[model samples]
Target: MLILGIETSCDETAAAVVADGRTILSEVTLSQDLHNLYGGVVPELASREHTRTLVPVVREAISEAEISYDDLEGIAVTNGPGLVGALLVGLSFAKALSYSLNKPLVGINHLEAHIFSVLLERPELVPPFLCLIISGGHSNLYLVESLGRYRSIGSTRDDAAGEAFDKVAKLLGLGYPGGPAIDEVAKSGNRDFIKFPKARMKSGGYDFSFSGLKTAVAIYVSKLNEKELQKRRADIAASFQEAVVGALLDNTIAAAEEHRMARIAVCGGVASNSRLRERLKASSETQGLLVFYPSLELCTDNAAMVAAAGNFRLENFPPDDLELDAFPYLELGD
Candidate 1:
């Protein structure tokens, strides 16, 4: 089936045309840079940008795919778990397209779409695997039983890993979107320069906690003079990154061992982190387990994954109605 996927969950306005969910014919994404000025995403500005850019982006995606609207078998959109106004733009537009083209429409959960991202490149991958989704807004682990079937195993109790990266970077005067900035600088610094605390859950579950780690970094920076901070910035980044990576890896490995799952899939924006990828590779080799990650382009928010997920839902479930509303805080499995 050929599907057109629309995504406006956050600052990105994206559209894509995918064939049978696995093959991407064309995809176009426009990221709003206005968020950088504020050191984070401003919801109001993000909604306005999506309204302005979504039409052009969708047109370009369809044009690049070399298919007319008549060729589309269905329309898919992210309807919830994102900025409400931003999601409404995509949802409303998709609903209109579904009505005009008389094609089926499906509303996809943003997080669930992230999980299906792996299938866009590896369609043959089977289920019964563990998945860790770490991003700016979320950090969660799930046991994926099959398409549309997920059992959450763990999640962040406070700030997510990426959120911590951003907060720490801001305190250190590092720029917005802290993951790349910290990862790049940490390459030259020593990961052992400072020993940061890695939180362990007292309940002995797979849950994660990064708020204390963020506080630790904040406290450490408080005592540093201007010259001292400049001298040890890279070391700070390296040490902090090490701590976050350790915490994430520990829980993931533990979950995989406890469940006896051999395949581990890491998805979301943070999946693009070089250090995380390198560490996962090492762990896979040491433990003799299969590890999978979406391509860099697929790591962040995109419509291809939404389209892929919609393809599955459209096939197995009834089409969502035109009245389908935006769910800003919808949880997975809801």
Candidate 2:
């Protein structure tokens, strides 16, 4: 099936054409640089930008795919668990297209799309494994019993790992979109320079908490003089990144082991982090397991993953009505 996927879940306005869920014919994404000035995404601005760019992005995706709207068999869009206004722009456009073209329409869950992203590259990978979707807006661990079947094992109680990274980076005077910034600087610093606290849930499930660690970074930074902070910034970034990676890695491995699964997949924007990938790869070798990840470009939000997810849903589930609305707080298990 040829599907056109639209994604405007947050700051990015993207569209893509995917064939049979696995082959990406063409993909286009327009990231709003305006958010960098604010140090984070501004929802109203994001929605407005989506409205402006989505049409052109979609057009470009189709043109690049060497197809027309009439050739599309299905229309898929992300409908929930994101900024509602931003989501509406994509969902509404997709609805209109689906209606006009009389094509099948499916609304995809954002996190589920992230989980499915790996398959775009590694189509040979089967499920019955664990997937960690770590991003600025979410930190979740799930056992992929199969496609369209997931068991959420754990999630963040407070700030998402990427969110913590952003906040900590800002505190350290690093720019916005913190993950890459910290990842780069930390490369030259000592991961063990400081002993940052990694939160351990008292209940001891696979659950995670990063609020304490973020606060700890803030506190430590507050005590430093400007010169001292400048001197230790790299070390601080390295240490903080270590703590966050440790928390994510520990819970993910524990969940996979407990479930007796040997294959693991990591997705979402933060999965692009060098440290996380390095650690997961190292662990896979030592622990007698396997790990998979989307290419760096696919790790971030994009329409191709949404298209892949939509292909599966459209095949198994009924098409959604035009009455389908965007969901801002939709959860994976929901």
In order, the Cα lDDT scores of the candidates are 0.92, 0.92
288-332, model 2: which lDDT tens digit per residue? 988889999999899999999999999899999989998898988
Q: How accurate is candidate 1 locally (lDDT)?
A: 0.92
Report the alpha-carbon TM-score of model 2 versus the true structure.
0.98
Give the poorly placed runs of model 2, Cα more than 4 Å off. none
**Model 2 clash tally, residue pairs:** 0
How does candidate 1 fare on TM-score? 0.98
List all candidate RMSDs to the true structure. 1.0, 0.9
